[model samples]
Target chain A: MTAKISPELPERLVAAALAALERGEDVGLRALARDTGVSAMAPYRHFRDKDALLAAVAMRGFADLRDQLLAANAAPDPREALVAQGQAYLAFARARPALFRLMFAGHDGGPPPIEDNAYGVMVRRVRELAPVSLEAATLACWSAVHGMATLALDGGLSPDGSSVEHAALKMIVAGISAAKRS
Target chain B: MTAKISPELPERLVAAALAALERGEDVGLRALARDTGVSAMAPYRHFRDKDALLAAVAMRGFADLRDQLLAANAAPDPREALVAQGQAYLAFARARPALFRLMFAGHDGGPPPIEDNAYGVMVRRVRELAPVSLEAATLACWSAVHGMATLALDGGLSPDGSSVEHAALKMIVAGISAAKRS
Candidate 1:
């Protein structure tokens, strides 16, 4: 009998894990099985264990975010690029709050096995665009945008009350943009 | 049977939880019980559940942070105050990474209820000292410092082996201070 590989298996598995996370719960093997359209034991045969599955899920989240960031920054205008990136950041946080939480929740069973992860890609992009040191640009861009998303999602800033987060994003983008003038 | 009161109960429980977090773990109740010298089940009586205890832990974290922010802003010199606040923010993030995470982690149970509990105090202080709108000052100061801290902790900017976190904090502080100046 020829062993057939399931092309949708990985995608379905990750989707399930992310869905569980979206509900603000842990995504162990059983949960993943339930979330996906496959048999419970089917994931075990593929992923080895929960940690392996989680690692894969985390990588998928990062990759998805990276793609989103790239798309947002693909705007023709540099100014629009920044705003697009900020809006994309907010959208990602709002859309996948749990996955967003997982990305930085810092649950390091070990350093992610993958080299040059999502953060590496983000930092590289910032360095490519700005004259500042890689670290400076990365810190400037990530901190401002990440901080806004975090506060908004974590209730540090109100989303419904005052448009405070919206205003903050504009100011932060302005502040970072003003860096070039300096 | 007489109802027992452990005056030291709250502090001990909090210390245990914070230590578990600082040590880098999920911080379950069993560990807290051992660390706090209470029965494993004891905390449930004092706190409705793990989430309740975590909420208290987050509250204490914010209170301590507020005290530090107040000290920073109270510096005799204006510029010095800015630096102090930024330094204090960094210190808080480093000293209590787990509690810091809990403050904004938005865990499965729910986000810690400390947002309305303590953020108002900090915003009120920012409004009094800075000429900007309360929303502006709050976002300017909070996002600037918080942004820098997140970058440092996530290893996004420090990959080059320099403490770019410190630099980022300085830049954010400068940015906010400059805002105040203009």
Candidate 2:
């Protein structure tokens, strides 16, 4: 049992941390260890501090986000796929506001290197359309979707089912396609 | 002299609150009253609680943001003016991140009624180009700019003067124009 449980300690601690954040409670290393039914020192062995544990939780968030994006990317049309991805992104943020905020927090010195995660999913779809100005198009798309999600979380956008968000996503895709032409 | 000084007490307390937020300190009514050299109970004359004081500070932030938007709207070309307005919005978020976050926080139940503030300023510009789809166009434009500002604050965008941000703004404007044509 020690052999089986010892290797799973890190995963258990991270799960506890994620649960804490989901419930809108401040997470700490000691609290996580207690919640995970482990010696306080056990968490320290797996994670240097609370930041390390939070980082692990954030990674899980990114992976979950990427999966949603992948599922949303199944549309036959490239443009529709992008819009679906945006909707998926918004849904993820809304469903996990605390985790979403935590995932993007404290990315020091530069943009978070999210290329291997959800961003790469967005990039692949963006590249299919705006290959020439790929970087700008991708940034614009991400900014709009992220902004919508952030606003939704902050009560800056309507809480009800928003046709407004749908139309805005279409306008962004149309705008990028227009830019390509010009 | 008492009459003159008494009226300015709320403003002085608000200034103190703003200062504390700027310095990245948690603010309290007692602390703000102390900072303003007022008796602790004196604040209750103007503000019911800390939330009321913070609300005043957020109001001041919105007014300041409107002023910046008004300044940025002075460009000769309408599209140029909109892009400039977005840059100013981003600049405001970066300059006063804590205050910016506070301005948008706890706006429960629905989107904050910002029609009289910065949102009104952007709506006027968006009206010029997309008169038909005004609601959707305005939301898209606001979402894009707001997202960019939020991203810049969260280090999701590069810290150094981002050409990507500029290019993204241009694409959004261009996209809205294309939507209008269609």
**Highest DockQ: which candidate?**
2
Candidate 2, A4-55: lDDT as tens digits: 4555788888888889988988778778778988777877887666677777
DockQ of each: 0.42, 0.53
Across B35-154, the per-residue lDDT of candidate 2 in tens digits comes to: 987778888999777777787888888889999999999977879999999999999999998888778765343236363668888888888888888877887898888888877777
lDDT of all predictions: 0.65, 0.81
Residue range A118-163, candidate 1, lDDT tens digits: 4564554555455564455556666777777777687656666445
What is the lDDT for A123 in model 2? 86
lDDT of 1 at A26: 74
Clashing pairs in 1: none
True contacts kept of 2: 0.74
State the TM-score of candidate 1 restricted to chain B.
0.72
If candidate 2 were superposed on the true structure by all CA atoms, what would the RMSD be?
Answer: 4.0
| TM-score of every prediction relative to native | 0.79, 0.84
TM-score value, chain A, candidate 2: 0.89
lDDT of 1 at B140: 58
User: What does the lDDT read for residue A25 in candidate 1?
Assistant: 81
True contacts kept of each: 0.37, 0.74
